[model samples]
Target chain A: MAGEVKFGILSCANIARTLISAMKLLPEVKIHAIASRSLDKVQSFAAANDVPKETKLYGSYEELLDDDEVDALYVPLPTGLHVEWVLKAAAKKKHILIEKPPAHTVKELDVMLEALQKNGLQYMDGTMWMHHPRTHKMEAVLHDSSTIGRICEVHSTFNYSAEVAYRRKGGLSADVRGNPNLDGLGALGDIGWYCVRGILWAYDYEMPKSVTAHPGASYNEKGVIVSCGATFVWEDGRTATFTTSFNTGHVMKLLVVGVNGSLENDDFVLPARADRAGFKVVSNTSWKDVLGGWNRTEDVQEVTLEIPQEAHMVREFARLVASIRDGSGAVEPRWAEISRKTQVLLDAVKESIENGLKTIDV
Target chain B: MAGEVKFGILSCANIARTLISAMKLLPEVKIHAIASRSLDKVQSFAAANDVPKETKLYGSYEELLDDDEVDALYVPLPTGLHVEWVLKAAAKKKHILIEKPPAHTVKELDVMLEALQKNGLQYMDGTMWMHHPRTHKMEAVLHDSSTIGRICEVHSTFNYSAEVAYRRKGGLSADVRGNPNLDGLGALGDIGWYCVRGILWAYDYEMPKSVTAHPGASYNEKGVIVSCGATFVWEDGRTATFTTSFNTGHVMKLLVVGVNGSLENDDFVLPARADRAGFKVVSNTSWKDVLGGWNRTEDVQEVTLEIPQEAHMVREFARLVASIRDGSGAVEPRWAEISRKTQVLLDAVKESIENGLKTIDV
Candidate 1:
């Protein structure tokens, strides 16, 4: 790996696995250290994985946060624990990649964002699917003016079988998703946030001025709310509505309907989707992207889609780390900002659902 | 038009004009007479349209309703007036096609249904687009099973531009669209009802168990409601969410996304959109009646679609009339029950919105 960026990960969580696998495939990055709360746990993880800096056991999270060799911190804790760790990492001057649902509420997110800027630390939100090359291709294809029509409405959805939708040890219910105190926010926070973020990314992403929702009512055995929905309105008079449910079956999709035509896609469960005769441009994001399905007669065009063997998030993260170390520009800096806004909107929606879905000023 | 069905309209309104133009397109039907409360209006309309038999004139709606010569009724009056006319037409044993937002509440809808059955009268809700050729193609593509995946979720939207949405002078909003006294229901009934009806048409008549909504508090300057929304769950575990706005710039859309792929279309509007890949199809509804899109797709294997002309609605309406006389199976008869159910669900939603969105029994 020439001119490589040395990276150290602090957990053996799913997100850690995603990052490590991607690191394995890239030449511009190297795994330097593996840390865990227990020395034995860290040693086993390091043994199966390649890390030049060996296994470092930290009985306390503070030890890892204070380690100077760790140029960036990857926090994949529960949604409830994000702010506490993000601020701790920011204080140590480490660049951060916090997993989705960056915080339980915007107030918590505000604290984390404030700390990042105050410490002059570079930061990014780890909303994985956003980094996919398909997203870039969609953005470009949708912006193809030759096809005609501005997108007037965006309809995004992702439903799941209620049983499989439940949290690690629980059943599917609104309490699991709606209780900000328990799940930090439910369906939208976990995956739907990505759907909404995808819409913003595909569009120029001007924030909506007003948001209100009619979310499904979810309840745990003890009776707590866990499911709901929210709609937002943009200034130029476009509207975006989203639904996140733990009680429904598998759905991972985002649809952007334009006046002239429409485009859509899904990640994790489904690939990119769009009207075949409208437009299909080359992938724009630095990841594997594919596009094809056209009608040459009516001037409709398409491009062949390509998917890299590795996950898109991993690819983008490695590049981001390398850019920082080499003093180069960010690979996709807007991702972090989009993630922030997505989080903020999700937080407001939670409030709207909790307080009778009142229209909130975005 | 020898021995053919003679169509005599009961209003001088826009929808009546549409029906008149539509009947003109149907060789099996003829606009024999038009009755209004004002003879001057009738004479002017008759003279301008060159009708050989305008039935002179009628100063009262009952005179028109009791006319032995008129076989069926197409009631496109104020929303508040739908129930009364439906009951009268049914009692008279006239096959009836009433404008949507059939009644202001579920109780009214139930009574209307009961009346139609009690009198052995055939009935149809004028959701003409459900029978559009392109809609038929869209349905076929959705159920193609070969391309579309398991149905995930459906998001249906129908909005008309504020300035162009309603009855201007003695318009329906003040007389029918949103006035509980006239329109009988708000956004859901006036336009959103079609979305609900479309879903039933798309999903082979699968019905949701419970419904909920969060209606906007927006009102036109003259006190007409301009927007509202609802989210419903089917007993089979599928979920549906819909929105209808009269204040926004005009737009109408219907989207069905499945596990492997999806179906996208704006069948009501010209330049009808069709289908896209990677979107799933969960509905049991066959593509037997699916509509085609504007231009054909080059990759016809996965991207099939149908486009229709504006007269599509005219042709569909004529089918309803032919179905009653020629018995062509009642113009998608199953939709009548769905429309009644939709009205009930809408009533419950309105009650919920007024009471902080409390969940109501279906």
Candidate 2:
């Protein structure tokens, strides 16, 4: 129980490299093994990433899951494969740190969550920004009534252009994210997940009454969403909107406006800097006497991190896993709940987009 | 024609004070007269604002229009009065500098523009931000394909909390902007004008194909909109969204994302400082090799102004008037065209909100 938590990664995804790097920075966590369907890819990935010598390599995922040394699993597989591998990992009694857009739908996520819950496993999504100290600092300001008051509106966007590469690879049909057989949700699942999660996080995970996908959603030849936007309306008249795309320049922005103030961050999904991050907060904003200018300027509040946000995620996930393994604590339901809420909203947005952009009740 | 262009005030509204102050700063412009429906109000406003001793005082707007020495009129009256006064001013052959939300509808604006065109008078709106040097600099970035590339998306918001004051004044019924018989359009016309104009300006005045008002638009008891949002879709897949309110804290933000880059300005409507304004631009954005951070940081580009934006606006207006009166130029139609386009979109958003949040074709 006092030893480090062992993590076995289930794929050779580009994102897995980031997780492995983060694990290397945490003293309480260790990358115990890695696997891919092809032995050559696993060996090359391990070598390229400088995986520890003691870490085992498996050509098949089943072999890694059978290794009792791996107390927890980091599943960075395609969203379409999450349900299959996550259920298998849960049956092996492994705590999970899964990639986002956790599954193709909330139903799939729920089935996987039930298995983990029954096995008493710690479960958390791979939204690293949520683990950043800057996030918690911003939350403190949002929670303080005098600082931001009641949130009235929110807008978030996460976009990056992937069209150039997709075209070079003989169009979107060859892209993993654009292939319905591999990642069916396309841009909505791969990137829009961050925007939806950001809106839910800003609202403290309260589900919206209705979700309406903005019109003109772009789709690939295979009918996978390439770009989309949606609006969320709550029962109390509060509202939020988000946009995600694989056809625009990289942009990650989150703006939350309250009755008394507002807060904004340009890098809500990933910090532009690794050691420190900041957000702008302006409270009690008022005009200079004759409206020539604002009475107060936006204040930039920065939080310094000893390590990167992904490292923080690894440390937090390991701490939870350690507690559960030592019988010192029960499984934390908050993480799964957050992931479920995000997936539910993502599903609602997809439904609205598919149903002629109709308003879908959550 | 060699003398300074003389200006007459059409109302003693609060905003006229700022215009008067701006006129005082420009050597080519002179405040020749002040007028209001009430003599006492006009006299008090002139005294309070330190009007020149030679400036004439009129008890009625009709008298100000009849003044032979006044070359132009600055109309800052309520939105409902624009069509009437603007047409009257045009008939008198006076150059006009009108406040924004040019008219209640595009049809009314067209009628006013027609009158102005027939009279051969220069027509310009009082959107001071457009005249700022910073605006031109940002435009340069937008026009350069390498900097921001083809504009893909835009999000603008201009909100100010007037709820506390409105509640104190008998629940919005007694408020000027909330009064259906006066401003009529409420927050949408009053503050949303800036957001609509901002979006139009960012898109270089291209009209969108359709507009859909987001749900949960709040309205007063008299059916005046207090808060609202809308999404705009262009034929080429470029899109924009905007939100305006009298129920949230002060916020003026314009974010434009392009295929290769993005630009954002927090104080787009009114700069945070009078002497300087700035915007953040980031081009060719990409993640670092291992996704630890961004490869480049957003650059803050600032432009210093020799005078306030309002002063620059007055100076520009006077220049155009001087050119027209001297037989050196004709009325510039660009200003009127921009105003008309913004009004058309604003009308569409209002229509969408009124008709059950339907998507209205532009």
Candidate 3:
């Protein structure tokens, strides 16, 4: 426990509550501090969530960063604020775990990543599903040429209907995600981030040659994208597509098709159950003789987990933090690299949407 | 049985063999004749498929069409030949069940359809899944607002890897689907027809305002498209996308997302089993409190069938033919209209692909 990574949560955002609960399962991770612009809000959040009595509560993010006991920070601020707080956290030598759509653009993210690298601080975007055991199993199948052959296409979707209260407000200006000033990327940055990441992960992070936005993207009154989709094409004829929205029913699906097989998971971002996650794989698929039906149906594969995916994410992040703290490893660049590629594609999609849905060179 | 519709088979194509087998289950249908360019080939096919001893065998399509006993024609000729044979069949007053991508172009299909309409002949394309009981069940869910409200997006894919012998021929020109002179549209016309039809079916035959082909369409040496995708956008902001290929594993997936729910089926085109077909639906989908996992997972709904979908298709066609022959009904316009809309979209996709992936007005 001496090398425990103490996490100072920078906001009382709803997502932070989930992270706090996940951290509870890891001894290597400690909820060292909670901070908010409002001291009363931080106090209520901590007391309501049963935060340890000894854990520090800060009225401002600066106070938490200045706390010598806090070794890392979980910045769940609006995307617009990531660069500012992340740069400040790196300056303070705090390892950072930030929310996704890591920045408004790849250039913005590169600045923060550079600062984190210079400070020898660990950095990872909070894409919890990346750490799930099921994800690893799916990857194993994807990598096996005999199982999937050469990757041909990938399709991912992440969508959810906004609450009635949010939609009834007319402009949804009150919600950070729908407010252009707070999260300009809107649904694309919030939920679409997961879809873009899922597609990239299936392709093993190979950068697509071009990105084209599908037409008819829905936008809020403030010109923030509420729903949109885009297609990605690789130089080798492999293609991928993703759709994201805050104006549709919840759906998190990822499908990867290859020359000989396919893999699909409906709850790729978050499983239907915390105790286990499942995906369906169909290998060497063909029609039955005489074309009556399929010769073989997809097999549903499940991976049971001792802890939820979010907890696994916390444990993994903490393990990296601990290694860096003990001088046993340099900062892991894989997470930062993945986040950068996702952000790059996210920016390309936005660019394509803005420019008459023309295909953008990635 | 006195008014049984006698169907004349055109060519000994592999698909015709399946149709002949399906027709065996329909007492209202009788195989009156089998035809091919070669009399020996037709004789071999009739023998191999166990055609009834009384059925006629013809050395040419014209000879079969001339047989007065044949009330309808099952035309499984390559797409390039549809216009010629379909027009000839209409002139002969034979009801027609032609294979999909009914013609290479909508103009050609329009000519054939006009001739059929003027001749008072029943016309239907060979899209077997449309006749499946499971398709009706899935449609009921899609139409129910409470189950899946306000459809927003649809995605369909129909892909199958070419046989090794076809690919080993260096250009796949040996296969009709891969030969520009025979089926120039190639995958887009063959498998892609199902995807376009599936999308149109999901949208209730509503015509899209625009169609845009995705980049990276693969082609054989003869300039026939072997793989491609396209996006369709409606006037009401509903969007649909489809991918089809002869260079990937078998995949028949359809996903429809609405404001309140979603429906998905992996085997949308062909069921994995002949006796039962299934689709999954998730209503009012939402994340669990605290964003842990899905509140409710998709429920797989299966519809048991008394006969295979192909048999269902054959029976339905036969019923229509019987009705027309018995003076109980005139030619049904619904089937022709559905086929027309699908062909229009299919042509638009090809035009878009040929025109630098431009967005084409539907």
- Residue B361, model 3: lDDT of 95
Q: Per-prediction DockQ, in order?
A: 0.10, 0.65, 0.67
What's the distance in Å from true for residue A253, model 2? 0.8
Best of the two (1, 3) by DockQ = 3
lDDT of 1 by residue, B54-169 (tens): 34456556777777666667677877777787787777766676777777777877788888777655566666656455556667676776655556457777765434334364
> lDDT of each structure?
0.59, 0.88, 0.88
Over A301-359, each residue of candidate 1 has an lDDT whose tens digit, in order, gives: 44333333233555566667667667785445565577678877887776776776577
Error of 3 at B115 (Å): 0.8
Which residue window of length 10 is worst by lDDT in model 3 chain A?
A163-172
Error of 1 at B302 (Å): 10
lDDT of 1 at A35: 59
Quality of candidate 2 docking, DockQ: 0.65
> Which regions of candidate 2 are displaced past 4 Å?
A164-173, B164-173
**Over the stretch A1-362, how does candidate 2's per-residue lDDT look in tens digits?**
25899999999998999998888888898889999998999999999999999989999999999999999999999888999999999999999999987888999999999999999999999999999999999999899888879998999999888775467676556877988877899999888998888898899989999999888798888889999999999999999999888987789889999998899988888988898899999886777755367865568999988899999999999999998888887898999999999999999999988887788998
- CAPRI quality of model 1: incorrect
Per prediction, the TM-score for chain B is 0.80, 0.96, 0.97
Better of 2 and 3 by DockQ: 3
